[model samples]
Target chain A: MAAARSDRAPRRPTISDVARRAGVSTGTVSRYLNGGHWVSAESSKLITRAIRETGYVANSTARQLRTGRSGTVAFVVDEAPARFFEDPNFEALVVAVGDALAARDRSMVLLLAGDAQSAARAETFLVTSGVDGAVTASAHPEHQLFERIQAAGIPLVNVGSPTGLEDRIAFVAADEREGARLMAEHLIAQGARRIAVIAGPAHSPGGTLRPDAFTAAVDASASEGAAPVVIGLRHGDYTVESGRAAARTLLAEHPEIDGIFAANDQMARGAIDALREDGRSVPEDVLVGGFDDSAFAGTEVPLLTTVRQDFGRIAEELVDALDKQIDAGVRTNVIVPVQLVVRDSTVRPGS
Target chain B: MAAARSDRAPRRPTISDVARRAGVSTGTVSRYLNGGHWVSAESSKLITRAIRETGYVANSTARQLRTGRSGTVAFVVDEAPARFFEDPNFEALVVAVGDALAARDRSMVLLLAGDAQSAARAETFLVTSGVDGAVTASAHPEHQLFERIQAAGIPLVNVGSPTGLEDRIAFVAADEREGARLMAEHLIAQGARRIAVIAGPAHSPGGTLRPDAFTAAVDASASEGAAPVVIGLRHGDYTVESGRAAARTLLAEHPEIDGIFAANDQMARGAIDALREDGRSVPEDVLVGGFDDSAFAGTEVPLLTTVRQDFGRIAEELVDALDKQIDAGVRTNVIVPVQLVVRDSTVRPGS
Candidate 1:
C-alpha cells in the first residue's frame, strides 16, 4: 500500500527545484513565495522566471493534504453578535489576521460562536469542516468553544492568554498586566489622587488581569505611611453603554475620584461621555486612560491616552504559532509588547 | 457506467425518508434541517427522532459533490482594509450573512480584494477555490473583482445595485436613490433652504445615485420660475475625516447653507464636528442628516437623522438569491425598503 501510494504521487515541482533553477537558497525562494517583501528585486525576478520554467504551481492544498492538513483555518470570535459588531478592536484584529493568512496563501473562515448552540455548531464544523487549524480571538473564559476544539485534538492558537487552559494550548497576547500598570502609573503621574476603574467582564482574561494589575500598581505607588484608598471598582461587559453605566455608579459612590482607568477604549469613551454629562472636563478635571487604542481613541474630541497593542504584530505571531504547531507538532506562547500613547485626555491642559 | 454509478451510491437515508417517518411534508423536513426556526416544536422533535432513527446526516459537502456543487460561499468585500474596518455597515452585513449561511449549514470564506493584485488573487481563489457561489458587498463600480467573478461564470449576488451591470447579475440592495430622496425631502420639510451634500466616492453606486437623487428631489420641490439653486456639492470617501473636509469646503463656499446631507453616517458625524467647530448649532443654524443609520448614528450626542436599511433582510436576500442560483440555475434581484429616522440633529430644539 505504501509503495502504491508513493507511485501515485503527482510529479509536482518542489521549492528546492525552483531554488536550484534560480541559483538561490531555499530560504530565499520560500520568502519570495510568502510575499516577496524581503526578497531583492533581482532575486524575485530570477525566482519568478525559474518557477515559470519549472511549471511550478504552489498548490498549497495538495501540499497541506500530504502533511495531514486541510489547507484552511478558522478565525473564531467568541463574542455575542451585538458585542462583536460594537467593538472595533475585534474588527482590527480580524482584518490583520486575514491579511497575514492571505500573505501565506491560506484562506480564513470566520466563525462566531457565542452561545451553546453556536458553540456546538462551531465544534461540529471545526471537526468535520476540513480546516487544518484554528485561531480564536476575544473568547470569554467561560465559553466552551475553545475547550471543544482542544478536546478534538485540533491544532489551535488562542489570540489572548487562555485562563485555565494556558499551559495546554498555544497563545499569542498583548501583555495586559503591563498595559494596565502603564495606564495606572500614567494616571498617578498626572496627579490623580482618587482613581476608579471600569473593569472589563469578569470572565475575560483582560477583564481579570487588567483591573488586578491596576489595583496592584496603585497600592505600590502609595507613600510610605499612606494607606491605600479603594474608591470605586465596577465591572462592565466592554460595551459603551456598560461603560457609561459603570461611570455613573462610580460618580455617585466616589464623587471625589479624579482619575478613571477603563480596561478598554470603548469603556473609556463611555466614561468620557458620563463625565461630560456631569459637567466634568477630561484632563482638566479628571484624567482618563484606556487600553487598546482602537479607532475611537483618536476620533474623540480630546484624544484618548491608551495602551496601543500592536494588533498587526499580534496577528503575525498568532499565524506563526499556529503554523509551527501544525507543521512541527510544537507549541509556542508569544506575548507581543504594548506602548503607551499619550493624548489630550491624560495630559494636563496647557502644560 | 450509469448502472455502476447507481450501484455505488451510498446507502444513506434521504430527506424524503425522514419526512415519511416523521409524518410531515418534505418541506417541513427540509426547513427543520435548515435551522428549524419556523418549524413547530412538536414537529421539530418528530423530525429529530426520525433523523436519529434513520441515521440521517445532512452532509452538505457530500450532497453538493454528487451534484457538482462546492458547499462553500465567498463573501467578498472590495474596500480598502482601513475603510473596511472603519465602516460598521460592512461588519453588520457580514455578521448577518454569516448567520444566514450558518442556518443553511454552509461555510463562508472572506475575501478582501481591495487593489488590483489582491483582486486578481481573489479572482483566482474564487475561480478555483471550489466555493459554490459568492456575495460581494460595497464594491466600487470600477473594481475588477466583480467583472472577473462574472467572467469566470461564478454565481454572484451583489449587495448594492451595480451601475452598468444591473441587468447582468443578481443583486440585493436598499434603494439608494429613494433613500437619498427621502433624506433630502425630510430636510426641506424641516424648513431648510440652502442645502449642501457630501457625496460618496464617485465610482460607487451610492456615490452616484444618492447625490443625483437628492438633487432631483430638490429640483422637484422648488417653486415655479425658480431655478434650482446649487449651494455646495462635494465628494467624500465615506469616512469621518473626508466628511469633515467636505463640510469645511461647504462652509467656506456657502456659509449660509442651513441643510447638509452626507451620503453616510461617518461623514455626517464629521460634518457635525465641522459645524460645531465653526460655532454653528445643529438643527438651529444647520440641520445635518446622514445615510445608513449605523451604530454611531444613535450613539452620537444629537443623534443622527439618517436612512435605516434593513441589513438583516438584505443579508438574508443575498444568501437566498445565491442559493437559488446554485440550486436551480435561477437569478433574483431584490431591492429592500429604507426608512427615514428623524432625530435631534434634524429637529429644532423646542419644536
Candidate 2:
C-alpha cells in the first residue's frame, strides 16, 4: 500500500489528500479520525482505507485538534528537574506510568513546574497544548498548577492525599501510615531504644503522615507496657545530603540515638553515611530504615530495610481513573498497599 | 483572553467551526494553521481571528495533520525500560534531549526498541505516528528500526559513530577515542603496571572504540619508554553486574592486575565492588577509572575518576541537525569532545 502511494506523491500525504482520495468532505475525514463521533460507518471505512493508502499516521494528534480529543496526557511534576534522577523513586512511577499509558495507546508528555518561571510557562502551555488530561504529583501549597489545569478544563489525577482543591479531582496514593507503622514495629523488634526520625519536608504528605504514624505506633506499644524508647524528629528535603545534615543535627541534640527511620531511601542512605562517619556499625550500633525501596536502596553498604509502595498499582490506577474520567466524567480516589522489605540495615546478624 | 473565551465555549472548538466563522474552506483554515503555507495573508488573518474567537487551542496538532508536518519527534532508545533508571547515564542524556526539545516548542515521545515486540511496535508506530523526525542511540546489528523510520521518510539523527547507514542520516557523537586515550594516560601516570579493561558490548561503538583507543594509547606509551603494563580485556553488557562478573574473570586470569578501567561509570563502580570483595582497597591496591561522568560516578566509595562527555552540547547538536534536516533537507555530522575528571578513585591519598 505504501509503495503504491510512494509513486503517486513525492511529499508526505495531507488530510486534504486523504479526504480527496476518499471522495468525502475534509470534515468527514477529520470526524472519522477523531473517534468517528459523528461520521457514518460507511465514511469510517472509506477514511480508514484512505489513511492506509495515504500512510497517514499523524491522524491521531491532528484529528484530535480538528475535533475535541487531544490523544495525549501530561504527566506533571512540580519539583526541580533533578529530583527525577536524584530521588530514584520517581523513576519507578514514571516508567510504570509510561508503560501503562503506552499499553493504552496514549502518548505521555512530561511537564515540570518547579520554579515560578516554569510554573507560569507550564500554566500557559497546559492551557494551549490541547492535552486530554493530567496526572500531577504537585504538593505545592498554592494549588496554582491545579487551578490552571482545572481552569483549562483538563481532567486531573493527583498523587498522594488531596489538598482541598475541588472535590472533583481524582487521586491515587499509597498507604503511608501503614508503611511507617510497619517500619517502626520492625525497629522496635530489633531492640532499638532511642529512635530518631528524618522526615521529609513539612508541607508534603509523606513528611507529616509518615512520622505521625510512626509516633502513634510507638505510643501504642508503650501503652501495652513495653519499655519506653526515646523518639525525636527532624525534617529533611528528601535528598541524601539533606538526610546527612538532618542526621548531624539529630545526633547533636540526642547523642544516645540508636535507631533512625528516614522518610525515603536517599535520606536513609545519607543517615547511614553520617553514622559510619561517627564509627557506628549499622544493625550493631544502630538500626536504620527507609521508605521507598528505590534503586539506591540496595546499594547502601548495609542494604537498607525500607517500606515499598506499590508504584505499579498506583500507576495503573492513576491511568485507569484518568481514562474513565475522560470517558465517564467521574472522579475517584484510590489507595495502594505497601510492604516492609527487610535486609541488613534493620535486621541484626544471627538474630 | 482565556476568561472571555471560557464563557463563550463549553465545548472545545473544531477546525470546521473556525473555518465557518472565517468564511473560508476548512482546508484554507488548516493550511493557515499548519504554517500559513499556501494561505494568503488576508486568509491567514481571518483564520487566526476565528481560532481565537472559537477557543481552538487544538490548532497545532490538527493543522499539522491537514498539512504534512507532525510537530513531534521520537527519542529512540533500544534498551530495556529498566536501563533508563538503572544506568544513570541515560537519565542525563534523556533529560538533556527532552529539555532541548521543549525549548523549541516540540514534544518528544520516547520509544524503546529493546526487545522484538517493542522494536516491531516502535517501528510501526514511527512510520504511522507522523513524527517529524527521530534521534536514535541505536547500535543494533539489524538497523531494522532505522530502515523503517527512513522508509517512512522521517528525518534521522544518530548518536555516536555511524555503522554503514545512509549518508542522509545525521549524527552527533562524543570523541570516544580521545576520551579513552586521556584515561589510559592518567592511569599510566599513576604508575600502574597491570591494567584490565571492562568494555561494553562488542557490537556498540563505545564497546569497541573506547577499548581500541585505550590499547593504542597504552602501546604508544610503552614504545615511549614507559614501564611495561599488562592489559587484559573482557566484555560486559554496560551493566554493573556484568562489569562485576567481567572484573572477577579478569582478576582470576591476571591476579597481578593493579589498575582497571571500565567503559562507563556503572561498570567502574562494579569493578570497585569486586576489588573490595577481594579485600583490595581502591587506589592502594587497584587504581580505577571510568567513562561518562554520570550521577552514579560521584556516588562510588572512592568517588570515580571519569571522562565527561558533553551531553548538553551533544543534545544541542542532535536537535540542531534534526531541525535543519526537517527544514532544509540537509544532513550533518557533529563530534563533541570530552574531558577527564580526576577524583579519589585514581588518586592515592596524600600523593
Candidate 3:
C-alpha cells in the first residue's frame, strides 16, 4: 500500500491553495487553522471543505511563528532513564497522554531530566524549544526544572501533585490520600489487626500522602479496648526490588504484622515474592494490597487488590487543563477519583 | 528547592545578548548554535562563554526558521497505543532512544499513528510541523506514514527491519533470524523432539524471519530416522493474551508437544501461565523459550530462557545513524547481535 502511494507522490498542498480553493484570503484560512473564533460559520465550513478537497496541511512552523503557538507539549520526567522505563505506571500514563494529545492534533515531546545537569538542559529546552506547555510526571520535589519553566512563563500541568509547586502550577492527579485511606480501611475490615505500610519515597507527593493517610486511617479506626493497629512502616523507591527489601525488613522487625499495603503494584509484587520466599501465604497468612491497578496487577500469582488510578482520564484532564491554560491562561487543579479493587491477594479463599 | 528558586526570577537571555557579549554578529552566534563548523575557534570559544555567562537559550522556533531544523525528532509508532506500552521491548527502546537523543541535546516527540486516520494526521504533522527527522518503530509493512515521510525528504531511522521499504530507509535492528535460530538450536540440544512455535503476526519482520529461521534450524538438525520435530504451529499477535490463546490451541492439538517457543517475552509469560494451568511443568513436561529478554522475563516464576536484543545499543546506533544522516546525509543500516540466555524455563530443573 505504501509503495503504491509512493508511486504518484504529489506536491503537498499549502494554505494558499486551500484559500484559493475556498475563494477566501490566506488570512481567513490562517484564522480558521488557529481556531475559527473570528471567522464566520459559513466561511469556516467552506474552508474545512476546501482543506479536505485540496488535502492542504497547514505549515505548523510558519503558523507557530505567526501566532506564537507551537501546538506541541512536553512530557517531562525527572527520573533516571532506567527507572522511567522500569515503572509500568509511567508507561501507561505516557501512552495515555500521547493518545490524548494526538487526538487534539498536538505533539508530545518527551524530556527526561534525570540529574542536575540534565535538569538544567531540559529547562533550557523547555524555555526555548517552542513547546506551548509542559506536563511533568517527575516525582522529585527538589527538581528545579519546574521553577525554570515557570520563570520562562510556559504553561504547565503536573501529572502528580508536585509538592512545593502545588498551588502555583496546574495539575491533574488521582486522590492519593483518599485511595490510601480506603485501602487501609479495607485491610482493617478484612480482620487485619497489625497492618504495615510500604511507602514510596518521602519527597514524592504519592509517597508522602499515601503513607500519611494510611497511618491516619489506621489510627482513627483503633478501638479504645483494642491493641495498636499499626505494627511497622518501611519506605520503598516505588520499585519491586525496593518493595521486597522493605517487606523483608518489615517481617524481621514486626513478625506479628498481618497485613501490608504497598505504595504501588510493583512494590506489592515484590512484597508478595518476599513473603512467599519466607513461607508465608497471601491473604491466608498475610493480606497484601497494592496501589495502581496496572497491567501486571491482574497477571500476578494472587491478582493484586489495588487502588485503581484512572490514568486515561487523568491524561485527558491533563491535556484539557493544559489546553485551557494555553487558550485562556487558566490554571486549574484537577484530582481524579480512585477506586479499590479486591482480588485474591487481599481476600481469603473461602471468605 | 523549586520554591527557593522561584523567589528571584531572571530575564532569559537571547541571541542578540549573546552576540553583544561575545562581540560577534548575530549570524556568527547562529552559526555557533547550528554546529560551529564554519566559525573560527576563538570566536566559537567567545560565543560559548558568552552563552554561559548570559544563560542564552536560543529560541528554537526562530532558530528553526533560520536553520530549517526543528531540533525535534518524531518517534512514530504505527501500532495501537496499548500494544506500544504493553510490550516491555517498546519501552526499553523508547527509553534508550530518548536517553541517546537527550545526550545529543535533542527532544523526542512521540507520534502514534495507529489506524489510517491517525496515520494521516501523523503524516500531516510530520510534513508540516518542521520535525528534523523521524524514528519509526512500526511493525506494519504497509504503514503509509513512512512513505509520506520519505516523500517529504525527511531522514528516517526504523527500529525494526520494516518490510518493503528496508532498502530505502535507514534502520537498526537485531539479527532476528540468527536469534531465532540460536533459540531453536538451544531447544533441540535440550532433547526436545516435539517442538511447537507460537509465532508473531505474519506481516511483521520478526513474525516472518523468526519462525522461518527456527524452522530452518530445526530442519537442518533433523535426522534421517526422525519423524517430525514441529508438532504444532500457532500465530500470536505478540501479546500475552494472544500467546495464551495460541498456546491453548497448540496444546490441544498436540498434547505430545514438549517444547514451545514464543516470539517475545510477553507471549512466553502467557505460554508459561498456560502450561502451569494445564499441569505441564516447564522443562520437565514442556520446555518454554521466549525472545526479547525484557524486564518481565527476569521476574517470571521460572526466569525465561530467551533471546536478548540489546535495545540500548540498538538505540545508540539508531541515534548515531540519524545523526550522520542529519550532518552528512548518509543512510546506514545497522544489524545488532542477539544472545541466547539459558535459564530454568528451557533447562531441566535439576540441570
Per-model DockQ: 0.12, 0.18, 0.16
Model 2: CAPRI class = incorrect
Relative to the true structure, how large is the alpha-carbon lDDT of every model? 0.77, 0.74, 0.77
Could you tell me how far off, in angstroms, the CA of residue B207 lies in candidate 3 after the best superposition?
A: 2.4
Error of 1 at B310 (Å): 2.4
The native-contact fraction of candidate 1 is 0.06
What docking grade does candidate 3 earn?
incorrect
For residues A1-351, write the lDDT of model 2, one tens digit per residue. Answer: 544532212233567877987899988865554334576646756665666565554432343445434556667787766676677777787788878876765556566556544554454444444456788885576536665566546678988775554376689888889999998888888888789999988767668889989878876674333464646898999989999998988888988998999999989989988988888889788899999888857775889999998888999999888877776678988889999999999888888
Evaluated at residue B59, the lDDT of candidate 1 is 38
Q: CA shift at B186, candidate 3, in angstroms?
A: 4.8
Per-model TM against the reference? 0.75, 0.73, 0.76
Model 3's TM-score against the true structure:
0.76
Residue-pair clash count for candidate 1: 0
Q: After superposition, how far is residue B50 of candidate 1 from its true place, in Å?
A: 24
TM-score of 2: 0.73
- Winning candidate number (DockQ): 2
Candidate 3 residue A308 Cα shift, in angstroms, is 3.5
**Best candidate, TM-score-wise?**
3
